[model samples]
Target chain A: MSALKRVQQWATFARVWHIYDASWQNPFKSAELLKKYLMGLHKPIYHPMNDCGDHVIVINSGDIALPGDEWKRRVYFHHTGYPGGATWTLAWELHSKDPTMVLRKAVYNSMDGNLQRRYTMERLHLFPDANVPTNLLKNVSNQIQQLKAKPKRLDHYSENQVKQFPKIFDYPKDYILK
Target chain B: MLLNMNMIVPLGILRNVLFQSKFPIRSMRIFPRLQLKEIREVQNEKELVIYGEIVPSERANILLKNTHPQACPLCASGLDVKHTDILIISQFVRSDGCMLPRRITGLCRTQQKRMSSLVTMAQKAGLMPNLNPANSKKDPKKRFQWKKFNKYFDESTIKS
Candidate 1:
């Protein structure tokens, strides 16, 4: 093929990739990997003080999973300051009442307090249902088939990965590896 | 002894043992000891209801912001509204108990003072009932006796 034809084909593939839902189960890992893969953070224009990353559209929020009793025990309290003003509601109750609110609140809380944080927040588009337009990537038959299977969801680790989690010991001696 | 001239009893008097106890029940005071009385008994209905009058949220918000009993005295910042801060304005009771300081309600000092004054004002205005008569304070011994009665009834029900 001529060099001009090859360049045109590559450009078409790039456009298709831009519209694809390269879905990942683990959002943290997905974001981190995509940051490097897409050269979002390494660009000469990259600034730590500013949020300059591309937008990430998250769908199927109802299918998102949490591993522990966080859904039930977590409580949010507020009051109107009148007779019987104070009230308590749980995370599960909030989720059931409004699923989109749950995800939005979670992501917003996860962000730092700054102008950049606001920018990061604006980039996140969350849909409680499968409402996103992924038609651009639909033409890529192989990619679509792979995405149909559950995206390998990433878990955000606060300290370390769960797989290498150290077992709790009542005594210091018990933690010694044989 | 009944026939003794010196031992004459009053014409209409009947000696009852129930009323002869060393600790006679004290009568409840009419004022200072604010107790919740029946609404029908209260002559003024206008003083009772604070809601349904469309009081602006800004007013409540302002009161909460400025004079909340739980706020800090030094700063306008939030502080805990302790049990001590809880003003129990009983209608007839002179002494109102305050709630203890707690971790929640981060009331600043100025707010607490403001709130305390507001509560006192509320009590004086008779807007808030000082106490409920049904929940009036009782002697611990009497409470224990009531518990005993409860236990007896519970046992009887079990037997049946």
Candidate 2:
């Protein structure tokens, strides 16, 4: 087959893929973004039954942010199929046990519970860290923008930049502003 | 006389007569008659040894072609083997979070293929970590240090 023909054939059958960075971003917002791609809502040929969803590769899931005290307040419940077997796990506890669970659960909960949901969920690949295999990385053509800007860490700023900021007033030598 | 009697009597009757003549009736009743082959000892022990080795080699050729039967651990434990089982069994994830090979997992070809796909699905679902630890720029062991901010200065300056 000709190169152009092969390329055209691949384009017709292939689904578009996107990479999402979940670091320092709200988990709920990331989940919503992931759901859009997983459902192929961005595509023109989306159908309810057809498995036409684009693949979403999520990286840095371990670093996903939760607003306020949701980490301690959120509770995940499970039962062991025995009497009095119900158990509850705090969000932080679950995140600590499985770094990816927080993001996975958020995305899973956001999706409609239907047969296609499972298939769509399957396409939403999540990595707890930034590392991704080369094969999957190749599929990612673009990165989805984070809803909130990542807060810059103090250590990330150079000494020059820190010193360059305009000073408003000098503090008294003896006064410690605790 | 015996040859003439053998010709006249039937084979079954001849054997009964021979057995009756050899042992007393009471002894015959107590012990069943033994076949000649059963009572006889082997004349050559070396011949038996040679036959034993030769027979096994012919049987081994047929048996060697079959794979050793090994049940999948999940299946043996009555657990429905899923992608999660693959991660648990392998223990260590690849730098890219790819699955360990079948040789390492001891899974059959079909199970290995199924597991590979499941791992991919798990990765997409945010259920598995995919980052290569070695390639990450951030120090994994860095501790979060607490810094006391001056209340006199605007809080926004320090927060950013």
Summarize candidate 2's per-residue lDDT along B24-97 as a digit string, tens digits.
54522211232111111123432311111111111122222223345643333343434333233223235455
Compared with the true structure, what per-residue lDDT tens digits does model 1 show for residues A1-178? 9999999765533312222242223333334433332223534455665334554455655544332234555676779999899988876566567655555666566555666666566655566666766652244332212122331111223223322332111112111111
Interface RMSD of 1: 29.6
TM-scores of chain A across the candidates, in order, are 0.48, 0.88
lDDT of 2 by residue, A48-89 (tens): 866678899999887776643466678999999999999999
Query: lDDT at B46 for candidate 2?
Result: 29
Q: What is the interface RMSD of each candidate, in Å?
A: 29.6, 34.5
Query: For this target, which candidate reaches the highest TM-score against the unseen true structure?
Result: 2
Residue A15 error for model 2, in Å? 0.9
**Taking the tens digit of each residue's C-alpha lDDT, what string does model 1 give over B8-76?**
233223124325646665642322222122111222333322111111221122232344343342243
Off by over 4 Å in 2: A1-13, A172-178, B1-160
DockQ of candidates 1 onward, in order? Answer: 0.01, 0.00
